[model samples]
Target chain A: MIKVDNISMRFNLGIEKNFSMKQFVVDLFSPSKRKEKKKKKVNNEFWALKNVSFEVKRGEVMGFVGTNGAGKSTLLKIVAGVMKPTEGKVSVGGNICPMIELGAGFDSELTARENVFLNGAVMGYSRDFLQSKYDEIVDFAELADFMEVPVKNFSSGMIARLAFSIATIVEPEILIVDEILSVGDAAFQKKSEAKMRSMISGGTTVLYVSHSAASIKALCDRVVWIDHGHVKMIGDAKDVCNEYLRSLGLPVEGEGNGA
Target chain B: MIKRVWLNFKKYSFLLKQLVARDFKIKYKRSVLGVLWSVLYPVLMMIVMSIVFSNVFKFTTEGVSYLAYLLSGLVMFNYFSEATNLSMSSVVGNFSLLNKIYIPKYIFPLSKCLVTAINFALTLIPLYVVIIIESFSYPDMKLSLLHLVLPYDYICLFMFTLGVGLILSAVTVFVRDMLYIYGIIVLIWTYLTPIMYDITIISNPILQSLMKLNPLYLYINFARQIILHGWMPTPAYFAACGGSALIVLLIGMAVFKMNQDKFIYYV
Candidate 1:
């Protein structure tokens, strides 16, 4: 089980000085030539997530549907042990496999085969484990012919294929993916979805974040609608997605609301 | 706790092997002489010093070959200086692995120490060759007189280098300019450590007592007694250097642990 309680994050948005150049320029140059005006106050503190609480049971496929800047990535990182929560507790019962940034650890100077082993080791797999599954990893990435060539020479899609292949190869109790399915071509996307399907079928808990309502409906058993860093609704995928679409003034299933 | 260190040992063993291979390859990748370049540096330094001191000022080695004495000190001092200097930048330079992984941060510094040890081994071939040549030329030389009899000194030198490297690596994280500062310190340290001159050159009692507390001085003395005088160090001297290194290692580790958490935030 995974639980998050009362998590809030704040960021300071300004320079470390008495005045900013924009403010100074505005103060010096008035729009009108008539009279002096009062100074405007600037807000510095901005909250990204405010008192968010949630719990995910074992083997649950939880789709996090949120608008842009809704703190989805931050929350996923906190649960993945990559970042600490500022205001609350997040207790996860098992090892978390984070596919947050695919291809993030690959060194350009190293070959694809070498990078696969190194990346796997960095992801907490021993060399023996990598050795046992080496053939499968290379075969899954479909780069057998070009495995020895440097990764810097690989195209963006090829790199994505390799990263996606290595990420899905590991078996963990909880898998956290953030906006991964949006990459690669349609065929590779299908392959990634199939991989996730197997993990779901095998009873691995997953927290997938995406803005696409269709993908969430296709994969997640439950959906969470988030806006402005707070949960607006939590229920079945179809119901929550319908409510989220309606809030955006889009037509829901069986309901046509004219904009 | 031992198991955690053992796990780290297994993890870093592969990393260190890879790094050493890479270091040797990159160091000589474009050079024409390749591995021979390691020999050329000390050889060239020995020639220049011998010509300048022996010919110009009649500064003899007082029965010992000037080349052998200089080479002996050079081999050990080079190891110490290079290891400490390289470790200063090792942590920041490996920021890619440092930021992504949560392993012990000391691995970066420790790996550089291993690289230095490898290079030191390579350089010792020449050291041995020179010692044999000098012994043959002198005719009164005994095989068990120097390093062959007094192996503890060389071990002390290695320990001291590891300790100093740990401290320098930790300090270099906060002060960006410490790399350059450490370079200057190494130059001054070589002069003070009796690497080029003997410790007895200082005649004052107060200065002599101060030199006793200097860890490098003890290290060079250990080397000198083994290689030049053919005797083992006093137990007290051995204990002093070993204890000092252990203390520095502890302090260095403590400082590194305290500051390692903020590395991602800064770099």
Candidate 2:
């Protein structure tokens, strides 16, 4: 469903320029040894994603396991076509619903109902289609009574619930989830996992990035471990999860604590 | 092509409608007279300019009243200032969507123009009342000059606004100083464009030639010619304004498209 080839992203650290001489001189005499610090703030390229390549077949639940700053989110963003890689290419052949950020299209002044339609439109659902799925979305979100209320007034959990409901309402061909399940209460998290499982079973390919090996084992059919923006391994979920857990110094299977 | 913009317009038409309605509501949200603020601003400016310049710059308005002459130019000038200033920050200001979605980037600026157009339309009511009152008061008033309210000038002004807005938006992405510099520029730009004074009042020939080269000067003149002078601009004025707008729009689009890929990184 998606292919990435030698994708890399280099960001310039000293992105802002054209500081005035007065401000520069003021910084030179600041209270906390400013001159030394200012001298070190030169433009440098930091690679967020380095020459990473991978593929996900149709209906495959692919887990992207990586530590913090492992470029997992960057890879997902490239696949979602929101950010272009500085080098190489990422080609995706499906309608992609990227759960990159919750409440991305929500207007604080707008009501929950208005936001659902707006967010659905942003996620590529036409008005008629959103209208068709409206009931199910509201039901899944469990916000039927508060449908007319403004989203800004909703609690953080309510907002996440609504956002997740809108994203999963339509059965997209490719779903890219980044840390979305990390939100909500435990029961809601279980509901989210169930919904994803249902979608995966019915031929929706998913690329889920997470730091939790347990979540990956619970959801994915295949696991692709990434370390420092490079693919570490790609194989069956159990083997990769065992290897990853072993690397983290955790005992495998029955050797662990009470479950 | 116009078709792509046309399609985007159709696609975003509902959002446009909602935003325009919301903008009107938001602008007048707390005021007693609501949208009346739009007309009040230009009317106040017209009165001030007419009072300030009437004694010093004595060019007969042919038969038009001084206030009429001032109002016509004031309306068009407001359109340019409002459109360009709003557009310069329109993209970056809405970084939420610009960073996430893939839609026509020009929509942000274009939407600003559309909102300002609504404001422009509302401002015309006072001008109409002022013109009628002045025409009745002055026996020699050139009623024929009212023909300048033709829709074509509005189109020309809008196109000019769009072209300039796009360029300013693109430039602002690279140089953040533009945000502050443009406030001073608009103040100076209004005087340079002959909004309050007549171009013929300038005794120097070089300044007259230079005014002809200034596209905003030409646009304001085009609006004034139609509304106060009651005649369409010469083919040369049309060619100059249209040609310059097209060139700026093309260059702006090119720069916007080239740098669009880097917006996520920069933002």
Question: Looking at model 1 chain A, which ten-residue stretch has the lowest summed lDDT?
Answer: A33-42
DockQ of every candidate: 0.17, 0.37
lDDT of 1 by residue, B1-267 (tens): 879878767865655555554555456755788888687787787788778767885665566667777777787788888888888888888776555444456776787877777788788788778877888776444457345534566666666677677777767665666887877888887777765555566789798788778776776666655665456778887788778767776777777767765565445
Clashing pairs in 2: B148-B226, B148-B227
TM-score list, all predictions: 0.80, 0.87
**Per-residue lDDT for A202 in model 2?**
88
RMSD of each: 6.0, 3.9
- Model 2 C-alpha RMSD vs. true structure (Å) is 3.9
Report lDDT per candidate: 0.74, 0.78
The CAPRI category of model 1 is incorrect
User: What is the Cα-based TM-score of model 1?
Assistant: 0.80
- The residue-by-residue lDDT of candidate 2 on B1-267, one tens digit each, is 789868766776655555555455456755897777898988988877776777655545556678987887788888889888998998788678756655456777777888999899888889878877886766544457446544666777787788788878877877778999999999888778776667787889998888778877776677666655556678877777778777766776777777767767656
Q: Estimate, for each residue in A1-259, the C-alpha lDDT of model 1 and write its tens digit.
A: 9999888765544423223456567656776521332221145556677888889999999999888888887678667765555688889998777888887557677788878876776566667777888889888888899899888899999999998888888899999888787567888888877887898779999998988888888889998777887878889989999888888887776666454
The best candidate by TM-score is: 2
Error of 2 at B69 (Å): 1.7
